[model samples]
Target chain A: MLGRLNHIAIAVPDLAAASATYRNTLGTRPTAPQVLPEHGVTVVFIDVGNTKIELLEPLGADSPIAAFLAKNPSGGMHHVCYEVANIIAARDHLKSEGARILGDGEPKIGAHGKPVLFLHPKDFNGTLIELEQE
Target chain B: MLGRLNHIAIAVPDLAAASATYRNTLGTRPTAPQVLPEHGVTVVFIDVGNTKIELLEPLGADSPIAAFLAKNPSGGMHHVCYEVANIIAARDHLKSEGARILGDGEPKIGAHGKPVLFLHPKDFNGTLIELEQE
Candidate 1:
């Protein structure tokens, strides 16, 4: 059900520094940073021709990324997103096979203004997985 | 310049079990496992339409993934590979901008029979990055 690799999300302790690295340093001309209060993250997207690199920073202490940064300090890879033809179908299929959908098992509007759902890290080899509607 | 995302690699404690999870559980048939002695890793690629999910397991105690697993225990996202039109140019540009390429600053033949170079995790917001020749 996965279509294409949509984006690889990284949680960064310092969003500005990480954004500058991809923009001024790497010359990717990243998109302007955005704050998603619903998700508790400030995000920026660096285009890589066919895909994107998402840099995320916690918006508040209760943010999940904040918890991740508390443990990792320097931050790290947070999740990988893949585009799916139909996210609801994909979620249903994964759920039927015993995969754990994160949160309330419902899709949320993501940074790209698309329906997205996160899968539990445990079911995905300790790597958080995200499914974005294509 | 970075092209498309080639793959997202996840380090796993057990290659067989991880491979089975992707195959039987997720229903994404993966490629046959390949052992890269030089890198001290055994890997499998699960096709996801436009990109692949690379599952990596340490072949030896000295493998980089082994060290990551030592810290994470359950294993996790290892690195991400992006395709570049000309890897040498990409490497040279990144170097001029002061990005620290890992190892001896030289490209090595990766599992896909292409020139690949790894960048330091420190230079990329604590996430290891790989550049592969497209």
Candidate 2:
């Protein structure tokens, strides 16, 4: 089942400006941008006590967030990640309930090096959900 | 300064269906729907241990989320709320940094009955941000 709310991912058109907004405007220290070639994103993490705010910018032409940025040029909340105890069991449960799993229904190593799977946005009230094994 | 991530608000087109999805598919217990007429939203809270996932549905024609739902018909992440130690100080700091505050620039009672203010999404990478007095 879902446990902690892992992190909220925001797809930003400009990673530096977004990081500066959180650092200066929100008065929070955001981590330096780290590029994840596999994920096709340049990410910066802003620790907000209990959870993290991830600022993501497209890293390449085929970046996952590239389409999102094209639609919302200014950027927007991309997905919400939740910690799950047993991802395989969770995926099965979700499947039994008629919820669609994104990708090939397999958990992929995520940004945190943990097993994660994305659920179809349509099945989740148009909100993209990422379930990460805790 | 910002403290904990209070909650992530998701505006759903169907409140009951959204609540059921979280309760059944996600295997989390969600609170009964609470309608906030002033805020023009009917909300359901799903506790995710460290923080909460707020499911919001437009309450009336004047609902603030109505326009958002119109654009994203099925529903989507609406805003992210962070706890602030001193809202007045936070507001001043954000303003000084050239971040535009939403509304009349005054903190209003939020769904949790705490003073809250919304920041312009354009200034925050297209992500609407809500700051609540802790």
Candidate 3:
């Protein structure tokens, strides 16, 4: 179950350029860029009221974002992050319902020190969804 | 610029079936079914805390969702609706940044009497976005 919209991730070829475009268009600047070495990507956060727009860019060929961009080509939205009160309970509940968790047990620390886990796209009709707990 | 996340639309093949799946898995029932005749589709709303998950199914072949579902047959996330204080200002600002508006002038009343306007997916890197002012 989803609690709140933590952030919406958008994949772009260039993070700075994309961030600039969004800032100029939305009249808001991103907080800062953070590199997630585990995910092989960098993320920029733009606050949109109660929600956030995460801009992602692949670091290299082995990056997951790179693989996704290769398939999408033109670049597009990558995934949606839903905030949950309890990550373990939410993961277990989804798993019980035949949803596959991309992560095993406990969630890993993601940007902003939040615990996060990803759900396999197969279980979500080809949408990559992340569950984050505060 | 944005007030809150009104809803995140997910393009699905069947409204009833998708709604059932979500209800069973999420342990929550949808608010109700609402049809937007002009949009040529029916929408089911599943509240996710401060956000909403909108399951959309095309009503006919001419429906916009029909064409979208045709391309992404596996089905996936669609657009992200950002709530705004003034629809006209939002639309005008986005347009000034070279974003094309899919709708004409004044906002049209959607499902819940909320004024809404759509922005062309071209400006958003293939992601259709809706701006709603309550």
Candidate 4:
């Protein structure tokens, strides 16, 4: 089962601008920004109580975030991640329910260094969801 | 400016079945379902951690949710609400930054007996957002 909200991902054209916007709006700056080469994006986390606001910016035009930004240039809420106890079990259960898994087999290490797997947007309406287990 | 997560909105066709799906998945049932006349929909809330997952079902074809479910019938994640301290001020500031306001002037009372306002999906890309302050 899912626990607390791990993070809410936001896709932005510019991470610095988005981080500054949240800082000015929320009264705090984001944590250090980190780049994920595999994901082809850079992310910055702004702490919000127990939850976090993750700002993602594509590193290049070939990035998936770039494609998303093209459709929604104004930036928007991308995905919602829920904390799970056993990701493999959760993934299996979701797959059985006809949810499509984005990745291959096992979960991969995410930007947070936790084991994470993504559910295809096709299965989850138009939203891309992530499940993480620390 | 933000308090805690108020509710996570999820779009679904069959409210009863979606509620059942979550109940079977989360090991608990949703709170009593309620219909909002103004919103033209019925909603059910499933408690999770300090937040709640809100399952939304359109009451008729004219409902905005109906359009959303039409595009993605498999059900998907919707908008995320952040509890705010002052709805009026928050709305004003977001508007100044070129964010489009959806509803008319003044915040209205929502189903939970709290004051709420909505931001147009244009500002946040494809996401329709609601801001609640109680």
Candidate 1, which segments miss by more than 4 Å at Cα? none
lDDT of 2 by residue, A1-134 (tens): 89999999999988898888788778899999999999999999988889998999999889999898899998989999999999999999999999999889999999999999999999998889999999
TM-score of chain B of 4: 0.88
lDDT of 3 by residue, B1-134 (tens): 76677888888887786777778765667867788777788989887776788888888668878877888876788888888888889988987888788857568887667889888766666667788985
Estimate, for each residue in B1-134, the C-alpha lDDT of model 2 and write its tens digit: 88999999999999999989998999999999998999999999999999999999999889999999999999999998999999999999999998899989999998888999999999888889999999
| Colliding residue pairs in candidate 3 | none
Runs in model 2 deviating more than 4 A are none
Worst 10 residues of 2 chain B by lDDT: B120-129
Report each candidate's C-alpha RMSD, comma-separated, in the order given.
Answer: 1.9, 0.9, 2.1, 2.7
By TM-score: ranked, best first = 2, 1, 3, 4
Report the lDDT tens digits of candidate 3 across residue range A3-57. 7778888888777877787778766778678888777889898887778888888
Go through the candidates in order and give the clash count of each: 0, 0, 0, 0
Q: Tell me how each candidate scores on DockQ against the true complex.
A: 0.63, 0.91, 0.60, 0.41
State the lDDT of candidate 4 residue by residue for B1-134, as single tens digits: 66666777888878887777666643446877898878778999877686777888888658867777877787777687777888988888876767777767578887688898877766554556678995
Which candidate's TM-score is highest?
2
Ranking 1 against 2 by TM-score, winner: 2
Q: How well is each residue in B1-134 modelled by candidate 1, as lDDT tens digits?
A: 66788988999998888888787656688888998988889999888877788999999768878888888777899888888888889889999889999989889998889999999888888888899998
Report RMSD for candidate 3. Answer: 2.1
- Candidate 2 clash pair list: none
Report the C-alpha lDDT of model 1 over A1-134, residue by residue, as the tens digit.
66778888899989999988887556677788899887899999888877788899999767878878888888899898888888888889899889999989999998789999999999878989888998
What lDDT does candidate 4 reach at residue B6? 78
DockQ score of the complex predicted as candidate 4 = 0.41
